[model samples]
Target: MKKLFLGFCLLVGFTTIAQTVADPPFMQDTADKYFFEEAAENVDLLQIASDRNKAIKVLSSHGLLLPHEKIIRQDVQYRPLLDMKLVALTEYQGQFVYLTNKAVLSNAWAGKLYINHNIKTPKAMGIGPDFLTMIAGENDFAIFKNNQEVWRSSINNLNPISVQHDLNSGQFLILTATGLYQVDSDLKTVKKVFEATNLTAFGFYGDTIVLGTTNGIQILDRNTFTITKMDQKLPWTEITSVKNIRGSLWFGSTKGAFKLRDDGKYDYYASKRWLVDDQVVDLAEGPDGSVLVLTQKGMSKIDFSPMTLAQKADYFQEIQRLRHIRYGFTSDLAMKTPGDISTGYFHDTDNDGLWTSMYLAGELFRYAVTKSEDAKENAYEAFEAMERLTALPGLKGFPARSFERDGYEVGLHANGFSEEWREKYEKENGRIWQLSNDELWRWKSTTSSDESCGHFFVYALFAELAPDKAWRDRAIHQIKIEMDHIMDNDWHLVDWNGKPTAWGKWNPDYVNGFPINVGDRRLNSTLILSFLQTAYHFTKDKKYKKAAENLIKKHGYDENANRPASVIGFVEGEDLSNTWNHSDDEMYFLTIPSFVNYSFSEEQKEAHFNAVKSHWEVERSEKNPLWNYLFALSGGKNIDSEESAWWLREFPMDLIDWKIDNEHRKDLTKIAPNFRNQTYTEVLPGDERTLHLHNGAYRNNGGSDGNREYAPYIYLLPYWAGRYVDAISAPQPE
Candidate 1:
């Protein structure tokens, strides 16, 4: 039976990996589950009518019934009660009563009649704790006791929209278009407490009355009767309903629903993952603290429960399973369609090699820490993909951006072609075409320096930790060929036309021409030093060491390396530092581990360590787990393990690059946008930030989607690296 169940789960794309282990610390224990029921069509109202757990009663245009947790439909046995088309239900005098268009039904399930209150119009109704039922129409309201009218009052030009019996205060509050009225316990005298021209909804938060108006929400103090507008604190100005669930205040609007916490912070839930429709009409709380939201389309429930770290790990592992599948032999594909894992289409990014290398590094660390054979196999496979990159191209040791079959033509066109040459190529494919001599495969050309940085960084790791001797030898050979190619071309990556690629230039003419204050000089110097050190360590080649020594002696590369960390952010005149180059940041941080790990001497190690520390100090505000984890590996202090965990939690489960707009959010503190496009939020990678290929950590406005979607390596690299460096502990199995 167990085997059959496992087979059934696999057939439906369920992961069988044991995820729940001994409880992990810093676990996010809550998740929102959604339910869409066609039977409850146009679900406009929801309420917890019973004290029993999960007995969530919902009212829709079609019927009224108790909604089951697992089933999408309410039970069919309650169809008789639903056929009455009851507008509202309430507990009155120890019996469940429901109101229809013409009369109030008592013992609703058994079709017993209560009071035939032949009301022409029913605007709102509520039952007080004293067994007094108040039913209101357009301009008047009646109070009833045991099916007999006790008193009635004329609202006088005011439209009674809703009536609430405050259980805590033991008072009846009536909401109308003109003003809010509070009735005395004796049900005789009524006083107008607050006045609003366009009052739509009202709820009680403790003793304070929250009124929803056309502009925003107004909080009226019961004692002082002072009104405070909450327009500036809400995400939207138009309010639909204001509900107080326990102590927390939930505001529903045309945009979505948001909860104002006791701490004055806000949690917004509006995406398709959380809502059936963005327009929220009403909200109700279940007996077990589950929130049921009523929308125009359907109902959604958000259940808060504790989630262990093992569960989160399993989720990320499932992401890897569905998205990061092998394409060729060892080439792991980062899918372009992020949310749609079944698309089977991968992005042709310029930094495919670099991205894959980061994943390889992550898997290698995973293998070292867990001794998992799966991790080892994944690492070895990615190593083969990286190896193929160097040999697949026309130029020896020149790694291609990516390689594909002849028919699979996608991504950026080749650069540095004459107009006439481009015109001729346009006749065939409209882009620079580089087909293999055999016409079977084609590799993207015009590779940049970033690719080389990724190559040397991962190759160094393979040399140090690869279990197979053949793997280490292949890594070493690739390092020599690539480094030799760079040196032979005078420290520049020569292209098909024998000219240095736009971004691969690192000769004295380009590196020394920049001012001492410029970041390019410092960035290039650091990269070249790291590359040369990596090449020399693996091949034991003196020429690579000599090249490094010459750069330090003749080009002031050592002084450039020692440049203060202030060169990181923005410089007044230096264009390079004025704007944050996220690609450069990735290259610098990835290179640091291998550079410091395989330094030529103690002096070199100390110099690189200082550089790494200084760089990390400048980037400390980013709260990037990957940067913090890498810095910890370089022996830096205060690695921010807690903040690393926070970052992973902040990363949304939906990896798709959906356009998110938070500019109109009133809760956010706005700062003057700068060259780096920094946001007001201190947390790294704000929600509005773009999830780009290399610059996923940078600030971005929410409306535009990038061509490439990031791989799981963005999360896996830091997670495993944290474990490898003892910054985070792995969860023990049950």
Candidate 2:
């Protein structure tokens, strides 16, 4: 027995220390980037300015600014300027100058407009602090002072693309297809500073010139005109534009737009969430520190400002609205092509009750914390769905996996059944039901242990925390019926065939037969103990306590309580324990609250607490907000509050389950896959990893073609749990 305990410890130690380095700590002040996109196409230019405490977007032909609004109609009143085909728009000495083919019109808020016709049909233009304008044409360029051409020069074999002025040094630069030329402030000398092939765009960053070429981005020394560094890590090779805003460099490519951080990494923003189109034409800084990206399908404003807790709450509120409206409370089905459809209707999942139970649990927490009527209503609705599952199959206590209208016969397999199986599933035996109502409800059969765990877990919460007596009584009734059914059937969930389901067995013979080192024995022991404790707590049944104590004393289940936590990764010669089963992990964690909160005695509570702490210690490295929050609620210390907040803030507001692939990202540090198929990285998976079930947000590589929207409860559960336990402060009412 001592050797068995030591072996379990060694197994857990190996899994815990598999990663060489810990993930970077999350800071509270980290700014979150928000995306806003419009659908109008042919947006050639973008400009930003502060107007009346708002960041107004000035397009080549129109201007408006409203951050919260998703769409802006064409007829709404824009800037005071007349609608015209303008060549360029720029800021000169705190005034906006709109350039046309024949003239330059400068406007100020004081209702002043100055038109200058000195330069003819300029291809590109720039304005200096001295109120001088530099204009460049196809083969000619000139410097203008006070609306008059002061110096003129002719160019050969160069088609000028743009003109720019350095605000710090007051030097002007002319960017052409083949080379870059610098013009003296005195307008006397024009020198060819750098030569590069297929030059597309250029920007000044301190003493270096960042050049965007067809191949990659090149950094050149301003004085020596020599290439210093080449960055080929962009998602796409074809560069379109580059802009230096406040200290970070924003790169626009044919595929997407990304910001180069000070640490020399990229935060990519693409897809419909960030842009209507991937082709970024230009970029400009808004007055409120937002980035305006000009693309083939109009403008997108990206705001990267730090959000206060209240602001985060508000954002979550909006997310709740969208979630309910588009992908309302339902089981998330598996999809062959995610994001291609409106919702996960491709195929139903076997864990529908389990998923809905989790969402129901989240709403219960929300109601407990905020006392919000809407949350209570949602919880009740979800509870009704759960309650209906057991009654639909016409079994006294059996809960089906899910239910759907009749004629939705995609998942049923009638031909493969044997004579014995058909006897159980026959219409006369009550295995399936055809409701007499207009909607013929047919329930899925052969429910698994995963669903049972979710049902009992939430049933306990509902019985204890429900606001009304009816809900509490209903929860108690469900618990009694399920527990009675399990107890009478020799501690196993019998399917419609009167045979034990594969994973729902917890009989003593089956559980005690497995090797002590295997996870199933330990998992079954923990779950049965939890169920017995919960059943006794609400039903006041001594038989449940008697059953629990017999397992602990006779079968040594107490010693096995921590054994599951000690073997989270692979074990030699044990196929079931060779990989991390996130489904099992969910079940394990979900059982802890009941196990500890309603234990049989002080000793039993202590045992459960130790098991929770041990599990949390092994899981801390994952930085899962749900795990950390649950641990805090279970009285574990060293909870990662800041990391929890980071998870909530970084969760993509767009919950469309879009296809995300980041395997080619050079900025990430990848470790070899562990036994659980998890690749460790320096940052949280939620930020870079592919979306997967029971996985942290840090997974990096996977793609989906169909839309699999998750319930907002994924976020709400942790958020409200953090609030309930005081791990996070509640936001002030708006």
Candidate 3:
């Protein structure tokens, strides 16, 4: 009877090991459509305008700076001048005109400088058809026609601020601090057209004239000559400049620039996301339907390039390949100068394993859909880097947070690490830096559940999908060791100290210790279940299946695993639990696939499907592609495809970490802060907000001063995943 029992145990609990990766049955509409992509480059700018050929030209302190190409860029081609201190510029009759302190000159039309040296203290200048010029000074203005002074007029001591050509009226308009004036094209009559206080700027919008004031904007009808005040909220009240580009009114204020959308809502372009500085000095129409904004320090071009989602994915993929690779791991760029890609360098991050796993998963998806050899090579390289993390520690199934060469560990005085902090860290986490087995490298410790979740999810996908048998076996071997270590060590990642790592604990005492309201309790339960399911799916081991069943039936883990995300917020008296943990969301969504994909029974799968849906419903407003695609894969219908595509299409082409602040914008409806940290009624579009991965997309305001360039994996992962699952389609020809 004892031999029979032992044989039963061996048959059911023991197993042979072997090995192994989107949401959705919906196909993305493959119609060729275009979306505007935004990026920024720094150039010294005093004024900007497109030349006759539609080439971008900037007036700087030195002279004119022309775009190296038709598009704006950092290394603008310089046109040096030693003749005058240029303060203003205009484009007219295929001639580039410039304004000095007391003279107006053009770029040697017919080999002769069209100079008006009589104009004194030039404050502003404007040019019309045939080089008809009006130069406004402190108290007077002069008009020149065909390089000849035609008329001079006194401004009534109001201090002229701007001179502009009214194309619709064929007249020149002069703006002073107090009012607007008009001059006939024949240079015969001058009339005071309007009177307003604190007039700052103006732009012609169709048949109406839009005027900018210190408080708000005023519009005047050209036919009726009646003025109406605009009451809509602006990004900032004090408009510095305004221009009409492509029939839309774009206003520049002290805070930033915003465009009036067709829906009446303003698309705010502020912070370093769209400009070098928020203090805008001028606005002009740029080449190829772009808008050039001149600020206190530099010029920024807001471009509108026609691109498809697939094209954008290729764009981000190129960025990922060109700059983000580090030791086979996808890495972000650290820059010495803000927004300068040339000054960028790659560095180690706390979530190297997690980030690389995400990128590797993306490449695998790309290969699955397109069968690109490049994508396969990318996946293979990332897999090796991750495998090295597990091998470096020499601890079965444990992965390092990151690694560096032997001499790269920061000293006590370096990188803000103090002796006191190091001592405390040693006590709690047992020395973050551990010499690898080879002694040629150092691996970071305190390997949290974040890394493990990424590891199991990606390794399993590799085992299942890798084309080569040896690579698939290697991936399966890694998964078996990791799952075995967790199960053998009481469902915890026992670090080198023989104690469970701080965030890797899944024991009932550790997970259920918290009240049902805490997210850790729910998340820990979900994580362990998914891990076991994945282990069993690949290894076909009864022990993994048994361990999972025991947790669910005996420990109430099933109840905890299905808890809605709404219930997992703000546990009072728990410091770390006082707010929603974004990192936890990343770990949860990343690992939830296994729970849904490898359910033990139909009933369990149904419950998991509902759990994924419930969570996705709560996050619906975020329009995050990663979460959306994950839910679609979990058997969810009615997933938001348009909004998900919008999220992907609007992601900024510039991956630089530029400081973006939205708390001060008046266009947003402020809401009382909640446990989820949602501080506004609506989430900002991707280009309008800070660059965030799936985790921080829900955050209202965040960014650093152009220091780090995030790896493009944040966009690549969802894009390629969507492509693989047929939720998104390949690029169609234009």
Best by lDDT: 3
Provide the clash count, candidate 2: 14
lDDT of 1 by residue, 1-734 (tens): 11111111232222211111123644242334335546443355443243333455555545565545533455465555756757665544435566676666655445644655545576667777645677777667677767677777766664677788877666678898778887654647778887778887888887788888767788888666688545656777577778877678988877777888666777776644456566787777655666777666656676664454445656666677566644422223444563334554654656678888888888877777777888888888888888888777658787877777887856545433466754765574434436767788777766788889889888877776677788889988989888888899998987655667667877889988887767678778888888898787667789999999998899888778767656655656666667767667788888776566556676777787788888888777777878887676555657777777667665655555545555666767777877556676654333334454445455544533322234566777777776666666567543
Model 2 Cα lDDT, one tens digit per residue, 618-657: 6666667678766654555567777767666666655556
User: Could you give the candidate ranking by lDDT, starting with the highest?
Assistant: 3, 1, 2
Show the lowest summed lDDT stretch of 10 residues, model 1.
1-10
Candidates 1 and 2: which is better by lDDT? 1
Better TM-score candidate (2, 3): 3
lDDT of 3: 0.75
Superposed model 3: Cα runs more than 4 Å off: 1-45, 53-57, 60-81, 84-87, 100-105, 108-121, 142-152, 184-189, 336-339, 410-422, 427-429
Model 3 C-alpha RMSD to native: 7.7
Error of 1 at 308 (Å): 3.3
Against the hidden reference, what TM-scores do the models get?
0.83, 0.77, 0.87
Per-residue alpha-carbon lDDT of model 3 for 313-347, expressed as tens digits? 78788889999999999898888987678899876
Residue 174 in model 3: shift from native, Å?
1.9
